[model samples]
Target: MARRVLLWVGDEAVHEAAGRVLHSVMDAQRAEELMRSYGEQLIERGRQQGREEGREEGLSRGRAEYILRTLALRGVHADEAARERILGCTDVATLDRWFERSLNATTLSEVLDDLAQ
Candidate 1:
């Protein structure tokens, strides 16, 4: 009579040989929780970026409006369309130049000259 020997392997071998044998160990709820957590982190990052962009836009618009008002007081007429165009401009350096021009500009031509410069 001959004696027979049996071989034993770990979980990795078992998983590789067949499909998952411990499917019950991880449930759907845990997976859902992990996905939800990742989504929340992405949303927070987007919100932070949006807030920074909004603050920059607000500051730019305020500066443009101030320049327009100053020009108006100096007897330079800026119609609603022109004011809107000025406010829509995002170039900070241009806005600063316009602000300086507004200080000494007595006519629309002077203000327009600053823009050309």
Candidate 2:
């Protein structure tokens, strides 16, 4: 079919047009591949970030619960304000310090004293 078209169109013009069409198709395919690759990478990055956020939330929540339980076991009664502060804290380092203090504290004030500093 191209041979017949080349004969009718003149060989030089037909070949140049054919070359342009081939180049355009190749460029289109290349563009599609690049977009697909970038899209996949973006999706994977989002999923990984979501996983990290979930892990951090779980750690904070678990640490808060442990702090409360440890205080109860040690007979250190956390008042309502102290309880809310401890439960609402999202910093793992602060929770860890509070947990350490709770193990030896006789009162809620003793457990949370460092937070005032």
Candidate 3:
């Protein structure tokens, strides 16, 4: 019943306060078990979120690299600042758009002209 009620609570602060209240009223051993279990769950959730974020960063990095390499192979001259701008971008959609532009671009401006607007 307590677990169900805790799940129903939308606010994290309120949920945590309710957990503390429940812990105070429970027997020591039971409270300890609840704490340990919830603690493990929270740690796992954090780890999962980190892994997901890392995966997204890696994907964006790969896309950026591909765009840079494509421009080089096509003989489009990108200056140091242009290289940095491409490498620094982390948004997948924006990288994809740039990559598409690079496929037929004859100059750096052709690939990144949208940024000027």
Put down candidate 1 lDDT per residue, 1-117, tens digits, no spaces: 000110122255553332232224456575455435545655677899999999999999999989998997888898777778788988888888878888998876666554445
lDDT of 3: 0.84
Q: Write the per-residue lDDT of candidate 2 for residues 1-103, one digit (tens) a residue.
A: 4333433443566556754664575686764554455456656778999999999989988898899999999887777888889988899998999888888
Q: What TM-score would each prediction reach against the true structure? A: 0.66, 0.68, 0.80
* Top-scoring candidate (TM-score): 3
Q: What is the per-residue lDDT of model 3 for residues 46-85, given as tens digits with 9 covering 90 to 100?
A: 8999999999989988998899899999999899999899
Report the number of the highest-lDDT candidate: 3
lDDT of each: 0.68, 0.75, 0.84
The better-scoring model by TM-score among 2 and 3 is 3
| Candidate 2, residue 29: lDDT | 75
Name the weakest run of 10 consecutive residues (lDDT summed) in model 2: 1-10
Candidate 1: global Cα-lDDT?
A: 0.68
